[model samples]
Target chain A: SQQGEEDPQALSIQEGENATMNCSYKTSINNLQWYRQNSGRGLVHLILIRSNEREKHSGRLRVTLDTSKKSSSLLITASRAADTASYFCATAGGGGSNYKLTFGKGTLLTVNP
Target chain B: IAGITQAPTSQILAAGRRMTLRCTQDMRHNAMYWYRQDLGLGLRLIHYSNTAGTTGKGEVPDGYSVSRANTDDFPLTLASAVPSQTSVYFCASTAAGPNTGELFFGEGSRLTVL
Candidate 1:
């Protein structure tokens, strides 16, 4: 079973604009992480926000987690063409063991240059 | 580079044929995982090993088998391929356990069963 679900299945935006994607999970998590995958490539770790952290940032990426609501949001400020990729949200913990990372249907973000 | 490596970047096999996907990590991580990604279905865990000599089933392990004989290698095998098993398979590992750290992923193995 999938633990996380990303909203806005697909999004398109101008290169300079900001893109935001949201995710909601079914169970309590130890930490929520986001990964990016380019076409025909592997998924790369982007950022992680623990249950205790409300928000965190790395370069142009910003991630926010709300344990109470069981939701999280990823914001990419000043998006670029290189940032065009599928973004996935994964949750660790809650569904039996903390060793498994359950990923959601990703959000496809397309940045038009 | 210090990361996970997967074999046969892509492959196509006839239905009912046996196939195996190889995964190796150099980081010496204690936990390793196999996940299959399908269109619109997202990524589903196929199998995982928290440490060498121990393996566990994930959400979707019905058609797959995985073995972790050592710390650096984990291989997934399909006794008889099926059309439903066609998907992109990824191998990943985490140094401290998935819950505590980020995962390092391999490029992925694309498999097609016809």
Candidate 2:
């Protein structure tokens, strides 16, 4: 079963615009992470936010985690054509030695030049 | 040059044939994983290894088997391929601890079972 589900299957925007993607999960998590994947390529980690953290930023990327709602969001500011890729949200569940990570379906973002 | 690598970028095999997907990591990470990505199902974990000499089943382990012989290699084997098993397979790894749960992935291997 999928623990996380991203909203907005697809999103299209022009350059210089901001892109926001949301993800919701079913169970409690220790941390939430966001990743980016280009066509026919491997996935790259973008950022991560722990359950105790509400928000974190890395360059133009910002990630927010709302443990109360079991949801998280990724914000990409000043999007560019290079930012066109599929974004995925992953939730890390379990504790001690049984830690596991579950990923969502993902949201496809297109930044048109 | 310092990340996970997978063999057979893509392959097509007839049903009932046996196939193995190879995954090797150069980072010397202790944890490795195998996942299958379908059209609408996202990426489902097939198997994982916390460290060398230990393996665990994930959400979807049917039709797939994995082995972790050493810290650098984790291979997934399909006893008998089925059309339903057609999907892109990915290999990933993390450091000694999975506290942050950040993964580095290989390009992926597209497999088609006819």
Candidate 3:
């Protein structure tokens, strides 16, 4: 079973529009991180929000974590074609020496010019 | 920084053959990980090492094996390749600390099993 799941398997939008993706996890986590992957490439870290933090921002990227709802959302403001990629949400489970991250299926965002 | 690098950007192997995917990081991070990405399945952890010389199983470790002989290299091996094992493999590393958990990933290795 997958620990995290993202909604809207695929999304398409025009440039300058805001793109939002949501992720839901099954268990408590110490932190949640968002990553972006271009076609045929490995993932790149975008932002991370700890369990205690409600929201975070980096450049045009914004992330929100709601532990109560076991969900998080990533928002890209004024999206560009370069932002077209797969967005994944990973959760770092609480406790244990694992420190392993569980990832969601991901949201494929396609930004068109 | 060069970051992480994976060998053999792409490969095609027969089903009963053995193959090893190499991953090396230059950042000297304390933690390393191997993950497989399949279409629609996203990325699943295959193995992880908190530090050099120690390894642990992850969500999907059934057909894969990993070894961390040193801090810079972590390689994943498949004893008998299967069609289901064909996917893109990624290697990632992170620093050692509570506040240091962001992973830096390699370009990824794409494997095709015939």
Candidate 4:
């Protein structure tokens, strides 16, 4: 079973607008990582937030993790047409092998020009 | 740097035929993984290897087998392809230890089984 689930299966916004996606997990995790995937292509690593860190940023992306709630959110500011793609959150559990990540269903974002 | 690459961008195979999907990483990472993506179910792990000579099952491992003979290459094989196994396959790799959770993926291979 998938440990993480992203909400708002899809989202649409005009250029320059901000987009947000949420992910909720069922188990305790050591870290959560986000990835972006273009159509029919590979996934690019976006950012990773450890359980000890509450928030992080990279370029136009901002990630927040709230362990108390077992949830996390990714925000893309000043979205551009190039930001259109699918975003996924993957969680690494605490025990056993922490190398494998359980991915969420993902959220598809469309940035209209 | 060609971080990672998967062979046969796409393929068509017949049911009961054997097929192998190749994955190679130049980063010399110690971990590699194979995942299958479907329409609505999202991506599910087929198998993973933490390092050379070590392999483990992921969420969906049946019907598929993988080997990490060397640190640079991890290959997934299907003994008897089935229509249900038709899907996009992805290979990923990451450095060893705690940071292994951060994966770098390949362009993916689309397979169609008839």
Please, what are the lDDT tens digits per residue for candidate 3 over residues A74-110?
9999999999999999988733445778899999999
TM-score of chain B of each: 0.96, 0.96, 0.96, 0.96
Question: Quick one: ranking by lDDT, best first?
Answer: 1, 4, 3, 2
Error of 4 at A70 (Å): 0.4
Report model 2's chain A TM-score.
0.97
Query: Candidate 1 at residue B15, lDDT?
Result: 100
Question: Which of the CAPRI classes, incorrect, acceptable, medium or high, describes model 3?
Answer: medium
Clashing pairs in 2: none
Question: For this target, which candidate reaches the highest DockQ against the unseen true structure?
Answer: 2
User: Against the true two-chain complex, what DockQ does each candidate achieve?
Assistant: 0.61, 0.68, 0.58, 0.60
- How many backbone clashes does every candidate have? 0, 0, 0, 0
* Candidate 3 residue spans exceeding 4 A from truth: A94-96
| lDDT digits (tens) for residues A1-113 of candidate 4 | 88889989999999999999999999888899999999999888899999999999999999999999999999999999999999999998743344788888899999999
Regions of candidate 4 where Cα sits further than 4 Å from its true position: A94-98
Residues forming the 10-long window of minimal summed lDDT in candidate 3 chain A: A93-102
Stretches of candidate 2 off by over 4 Å are B96-98
Deviation (Å) of B109 in candidate 1: 0.6
